[model samples]
Structures are given as C-alpha cells and as structure tokens.
Target: MTPPLALYIHLPWCRRKCPYCDFNSYPAPAAIPEARYLAALFADLDADCAFLINHRPLSPLQSIFIGGGTPNLFSPAAIAQLLNGIRQRLPCSAAIEITLEMNPGASVMAQLPAYLAAGVTRLSFGGQSFSIRSLKQLGRIHRPRHVLAAVRAAQAAGCRQINVDLMYGLPLQTLAAARADVERLLDLSPSHVSYYQLTLEPNTPFAQSPPPLPAADVSADMGEQGQQLLAAAGLQRYEISAYSRKEAQCRHNLNYWTFGDYLGIGAGAHGKLSTVSGGQVARVIRLAKWPQPTAYLAAHQSGHSQIAHQRELSAADLTLEFALNALRLTAGVDVTLFQQRTGLAAEHLSAARAGAQAAGLLDGGAAGRLVATARGLECLNDLLQHFDLS
Candidate 1:
C-alpha cells in the first residue's frame, strides 16, 4: 500500500497563554522578527524533505495544517512563503485541505481575506465561549460578538469550510451556561464544531490555582446536552470533542486518528511515520521536534534540523496506539483496521478487551470493535492506561 503523507507547521508563539491550556505554546512578546521566523520555518521544511527522500518517495501532501501560537498573527506574505516552501519540496493534492487557526480577535480578523487569497481553504476560529463572563474569566481577548464577526468575515472571504471551537466546564459555568454556549455556537452555522471540556494542564495558571469546575455528573450532563443540541442542528459527533456536518469533517485531523503518516515541521511538532524495510516487516516510528522556539531555530541554523526525542514503536506499542486513537471515534474503526495499520493480528488485544467488556467498558464479539462505552470515554485516561508503553 502507498504511504499517506501530510504536512504540519507549528507556530509556537501566542498572544497570551489561556489559563486552562497546556499546549506547547508560549506568550509572544513585542517585536517578534516575523521575517526571521518564516525563513526558519522554510529551512525546517527543507531539512524534513531530505529525510523523506531517504525513506519513501514524496506522495502528494494530502493535507496541510498551520497551527498555533496563532498562525493568523503572521502576514499573508509570510504564510504564502511557508506554503511555497512546502510546495517546492513536496507535491500536494489538487484539493489539499490547507487550514490555518485564527483567534477571534480584531487584528487577525482583518487578515482573513488575505489568507484566503494565499490559498488557505479553511479557517478555524478559536471561539472558546459565548458567555462574556466566561470569556473574561478565561483571559480571552475577544467577546462573543467578535466570534460572530470572525465567522462572517471568513465566510465573506469565500472560505469553503469554517470550523468553530467551543469549550465547556469553565469555572463558575453552570449546566445552563454550557447549554447556552452550545446553542450560540450552532446559531453561527459553522460547517464544523469542536467542543472540548476545560482541563487544567500542568504549568498552566488554572492548574496552579485550580478553578471550581462542575462536578463529574454535572460535566457529563452538560456534554450529553451539548451533543443533543449539535445533533438537532444537523451536526454529528464524529470523534470525542469534534462534530461535523455531512462531508465536513477535518481530513487533516482524521489523518492523525487513522494512524497515517505525516511530516511534522515546526517547533514542538510531532509525527508518526510507517517504516518498511524493503519487503520485510514494517515498523511505525514516532518523531518529535524540539519544543523551544529559540532552541529549535538554533538547531535548524546549525545543520541538524530534526530533533526526535523518541523513535521506536514496538508491536505492543502499535497495538495500544491504534486502539487509543481509533477507539476515540464515535463510529469505531473496522476490525481489519488493526492489522492494516499495525501489521498485527486483530485479536492481539483480546485479553484486554474481555476485561474491558466484562467491566462495561467495551463491546463484545468479532464485529464488536473496541470503543469507550459512555463510561469509558469519560474516564479515558484510565482506559488508556491499560496499555501503558512502559
């Protein structure tokens, strides 16, 4: 089978770190050298191309995602240059989904048209909540009105696909408030919706000084209610935290969930590639770039650009990997997906399955694909721990 390839570019700088976010993003100070950053990104892509040449031929890039500190902060020219660099080194499909993440703020909102002109086919708005009080509590700069304006701007710019992100379980957020947020989000009529519960990640302000989130039962009720709201609006939950209209799901993210290959180029980017040793058994290799922006740039300037902190994925590791991602989807993957993606028997994890099924975590039988039974998805971390890499 041919290997599937995609490109991921990371922008490590953010205007400010959201109190609840623990992503590998840092606050951007004044006077960022925009030109230098673009040049570094281009050089980073160039280095990745050299590595791809050693393994398999470059397939047309099926997807390209320019993700945050905030990709919209960069000028259209800078973004264009980055895309040009990818095109020069790798071939791309005619309908390649090129997505850029933008904050629902004034400055980035103005750049929507220019980004569309630069070949951005999709725009995803980071509209965390519609509640003005919740927005202030989360340290978000944009108001509910700003989010509406941003969506309109992207639509007016002729963007074919638009995704709106919503957050739940905020401090002081009641079940009523969460439902209101969902109602407001559906009112915008976005092609895609991503609703995620707030988690206080380590090193984040909310983690250090924990907020009083809704209780477990309350959070579950809020999630179920929001899902029902989305369904009524003609959107279906494809994966945990992600919902979409017919044919509106983000292919770029689906690539990640299906265990496809992608080249991650940018600070703190991560990728998984399938390695076949010329007609022998194939192994899946995981690659990660250095996280720090300054350090990564320095490494790129020096000669060795890619810095993979980890590489190997054993048979047991691959089984766990496939189960962990595939099971997250509402429509569980086919039983054959295990052997196809992991090159292992589908029954490899049968022992774990029996335990999970007996405990009301997974379904039963051959056609019974593994999934987080309602209770399992809520305590996903605990379910995932059953197949620990260690």
Candidate 2:
C-alpha cells in the first residue's frame, strides 16, 4: 500500500539569516521577489505532479507545511494566492492541516488573524528561548516579551492549533534556565512544543567559531530534566525532541517520521515518493530543487529541470533511511512498515534489528513494535551504529 502523502513548501528568504542556521536560506533583498518565486514553485510542483503520473500516484494532500527563511514575511494576500494556487494544482484533504512558520517578532503578531483568514489553520512560532541572555547569545532578533506576546496574539485571533519551538543547552545556559524556558512555554499551552538542543551544524557560523557551550554531561541533564518538565505538563513526548497534547502531535512531521510520502516544492525543498513494484517490492525516489534561490528561479524561467539533486534509494540505503526516521519515535514503528515503506526484503534489516535488541538498546522483539529504550534514545547515534553497514 502507498503511504500517506504530504506537501512541504519552502520559502527561503529571511530578513537576515541566523548565524547558527544551516538551512538553505539567504538574506532577503529590500524587496522579495514573491511573484517570481511563486511562479517557480508552481512550475516545480507541476513537474512533480507529472512525475507522479508516471512513477507516483496522486494522493490527496494530508498536510501542507510552509517553512522558510520567513514565510510570514509575505502578506496575507500573497499567502492566500499561494494556497489557492496549490489547491488548483493538487487535491487537498478536507481536514488538511496548513501550517505556516513565523518568527516571534512583533510585526508578525498583527498578521496572525489575516493568516488564519487566508486558510492557515496552524501557526508555529520560532520562539527558540525565553531568556534575554540566551536569545541574544543565539542571535535572535525578537526579545523575550515578543514570544509571550506572539502566542497571546495567536490565541486572541482564535487560532486553535499552535506550536512553539524552544532550544535547550545554549551557551552559558544552566539547567535552571532550561527549566524556566519550558515552564514559560507550558504557560502558553501550545498544542505542540519542539524542545530540541542547539547543536553546531557543519559549515554554520557557530561551527566555525564555536561558543563556550555547556558541558556534555550538563547538556544531557538539561535534555533529560526538560523532558520530565514537558511530560508532567500533559505534553506527551512522541519523538525525541517533540511533545504534544493527547491529539496535537504534528501530523505533517508524523508522516515524515513514519516514512510516509511527501512532495517538496520551492527553492531548496526536498521530497520523497514511494511506489510498490512486483506486487511486493517497494521503491523510493527522492528529489530536491536547486538550493540557491536565484539559480532555481533562473532554471525555471529557462524551462530547465531545476532539480539540483536526485537519486533512487538502494535497498541498504532504504533500510538505514527508514530506521533513521522511525526510531526517533518513542514508541518506534510497526516492524511490518519496513517492507511496506522500503520495498525491501525482511532479512535486509532483521540482523541489524536483532543486534540492537541484543544490546538492550531496543525494546519489543521480532514480532511486535520496534521501540528504543531510554538508554537507547540517549545514545541514539551509537544505537544507529549497529544498523549502519558503511
């Protein structure tokens, strides 16, 4: 069976790219080329839809995530036009979740209602931290009060679904400060919270001029204690860094964790698609757009493919890819999904599964769900070493 489908639209222009950021984002010009970028997105989407006809099948979209340099930088009218254009090009579910990511800047607060009116059902604020010192250390533009004010504005606008992102283990951060961040976020009662640690990704400014961060053991303690705080606040830990109320788990991200299918459109967007072959074998294909916004737009205007990268997953590649995502879930995945999503033979992954289970990093057994133990979750990279042949 085909996995559920989702859509991810990347808007890659930010007012100023964050120093700690490594996403394919660039600083914006005085005026963003919204109309031109949108045209390119539709062209990319059209090509993807055509590929679906030959190698993929059209499935009504389950969710749409508008991520960005800063999606809220665009006006409500532009967002409305984009969403309407997408619906005309693809069939979306009646209850489809439409999420738009926004910075906690004061300017975006006034735009919340207009966004909701334009069909954005959920608003995810990049509130990173609540401490003034930590925000400055992370080079965030918004002050602590802006985060509180943004959530309040969302509530006042009658937007029901909200997600707030918070980072732990910052430069000079103490465990108490991390707890305070969680406590303040819980006060907002966001439906979902992405409580993640700030790691120095390669090629980023942070990686080059690494700051004096908390000690490794202290960071570990910060994560463990922070999890306890969120769990006690009625936010269940679904994935390692994600928590949500009983039914507020992010459906779009859940699809990714489960290795479901999704279409990626826009500069620097990536997508995965699945198809079954020989009535039993599953084959997966991945596609990515040009990372440079100008290059991508030029390719579209010139009628070029605009795909900077593309590949088909080998069996071993599929095994690792599936495990990488599925194991992030606290509850793990249905063992049967390996074959369904990857279209590979069971033996391809059984030995690796047995090895992890024998090491006590994994729970359950050969017949039921595959789960990661608490210790396994803590040492996820080490646990993955068991499955990584390369």
Candidate 3:
C-alpha cells in the first residue's frame, strides 16, 4: 500500500511574537520577500518530491496544512502558488484537507475570501482568549471583538470547518472567568475547539519573568470545568486539548496521534513515516526541516536547503514517539495499533502500563485502549516518564 502523504507548509513570521509562545515564529518585518519566499518554498517541495519519486512512489496528496507564525500574513496569490506547486509535482486528492492557521489580529481580516477561494477548506483561528484582560496579559494584538469579527468573516467566506484555539489557567484566571470565555467562543458555533492550559515553556518570555499565574489547584479546576462546558456546548473532548463536532476533528492532527505518515516541508516542521518490508525489516521514520526561516529562505534560493535535519527512528524511538503522541488523546490509540505503528511488542512497555495504572493515570480498560485516566491526563509528565530511553 502507498503510504499516506501530507504536506506541512510553515510561514515563520507573526505580527509580533507572544510572550508565552516559543513556536518557530518571528516578528514580521515591514517588507516581506513574498516572491522570493514563494520561489524557495516551491523549490523545497520539488526536492522533497524527487525523493518520493525515486524510492517510494506515493499515489496522491492526502492532506496539506498551512501553519505558521501566520499563513494569513501572505497574500492569496502566494498561497495559491505554493498549492499549485504541490499540485504540479504530485497528484492532489479532491478530498484533500487544506488547512490554514490564522491569527485574529486585524491585519489578517482582509485575506479570508482569497484564502477560501485558494482551496483552503479549513481555518483555525488563533483566538487565544476571549477575555480582554487575558488578551492584554498574553500580549495578543487582537481584542475579543476582533476574534468575533474574524470568525464571522471566515464563515462568510464559506469556511464550514473552523477551529478556535483557546487557553485556560492563564495568569490570575478563575473557573468563572474561564467559563465565560468558553461561552463567548461557543456562541460562534465553530466546528472545533482546542483548549490548552497555559504553560510557561522554557526560552519563552513568560518563562523568563514568570507571571502570577493561577495556582495548580485553580488551573486544574479551570481545565476540568472547561472540558465540561465544551461537552455541554456540543463539542466532544476528543483529545486532551481538542474537541470537535461530529466528523470535525482535525484529520491532520489525528494522523499524527495515530502514527500516520506526513512530510514536513517548512522551517521547524517535523514529520514521521513508518515502513515495513517483509516480516523482519521495519523502519519508523522521523524528519525535521531547518529551524530558521531566514536560513530556510537562503537555502531555498540556493536550490538546496539541506532542509531535512533528522530522519531516523529505531524501534524504541517509534515506541516512545507513538506513546508520547497517542496518549495525549482522550480516547487513546487501539492496543493493536501500538505494534502495527511502532513494530514493537506492546508488552515492551508493560512497565509504563503498570506504573500509570498504579498511579491512577491510566484506565485498565477503556475501549481496551491504553487511554489516559482523568488523573493520567493531569499527571502526563509523570506518566510519560515511564517511557524513558534509559
């Protein structure tokens, strides 16, 4: 069977990087080298295609994700050119899920129609918070009203599959405050909701000067209450931080959680692919593109990006990778899928199972899947520790 192919397009520039964000994002400059970047992006994709043409002749493109710093920063023409490049090099399926990530800031508002017409079927808005205070605290450029306006504009542009990202347990947040934010977002009736707890990641400004965030107990309460509210709002908590209306869960992410294959194309993007030959030889692969956007552009212009940074995964690597991503879902991957995806005996991770179960972090039998117990989801770090490389 031909491996499923997915493309990740990364635009590494944002209007302004948020204090809490450590993503591969940079502050946008006054003049963007759109034409140069577009040329380089296509060249990079062409190089990736040549690899497949030589070794693994895939059938057609299954999915395409235009994530960013902010894909909306580019004009529809640039996006179309990139899409056309993919179409020219490979067969693009009609059912391909083309998703674009947009920030709610006013600057991106005008590109909605062009994006929709450019074949972007899904739009995920970075509506980090509906609370104006939270927006200010997070240093978001857009206000709650702008988020509302963006959602309306996307709907008007004929985007039915919309995802609004929200955050809870923010600085000085309360359960009541968190509930109100969810209510406001739900009023927009989006197909998907991704609710993430605020984490002070290392290297982020938030980590350098830690804000007065809610306490652990308060953060937990906010998370629990937010899940309950989202469920009541007709969005099922399909994963720890993701919820969706029926058939609306993000397939691109689901592919990752289930260990499906994809090609990482842009700066800082990562991908995985699994291949089994005969009954003895199996390879579960991983790949990372270059991290610096400016460097990527330079490499793109040179006709060779050396773009792929890492591309190896041993059996144990696959096991850990599978568990790390799959266990994040509320409904975990099937037990059989563990062996199929990782090419390892599930019993190899028996210690993880026993440890998590003892810690009340895993349900002994949920769909006969190694799913996260409420406690398991909460103590994820501890649970994942059971899979240490040592």
Candidate 3: tens digits of C-alpha lDDT, residues 1-390 = 334678888888988899999899899899878887777777777776776554454667778999989888888988888888788888988899999999886766688888888889999999989888999999998999999999998888789999999999898888899989999999999999999999999999999999999889888888888888889989998887999999999988887777767777777877665554553226665767778878787777666754657567865676677778888998887787777666677787788787778878878867558798877787788778776554
Worst 10 residues of 3 by lDDT: 273-282
Candidate 1 lDDT over 1-390, as tens digits, reads 435788899998888888887888888868666777777777777766776766555679999999988877778988888888778878999989999999998777678888988889989999999999999999887899999999987887788699998989888899999999998888788999999888878888898999888898888788889999999999999898899999999999888887778888788998776755553227777788989888887787777755657587888788778878877877777766676666677678777777776776665643646667776676666666665544
Name the lDDT of candidate 1: 0.82
Best model number under TM-score: 2
* TM-scores, each model vs. reference: 0.94, 0.97, 0.94
Sorted by TM-score (best first), the order is 2, 1, 3
Off by over 4 Å in 2: 277-281, 364-366
lDDT of 2 at 142: 92
lDDT of each: 0.82, 0.89, 0.82
Strongest candidate by lDDT: 2
Off by over 4 Å in 3: 1-3, 54-57, 276-281, 366-368
TM-score: model 3 vs. ground truth: 0.94
State the lDDT at 231 in candidate 3: 92
Query: For residue 132, what is the lDDT in candidate 2?
Result: 92
Clashing pairs in 2: 282-343
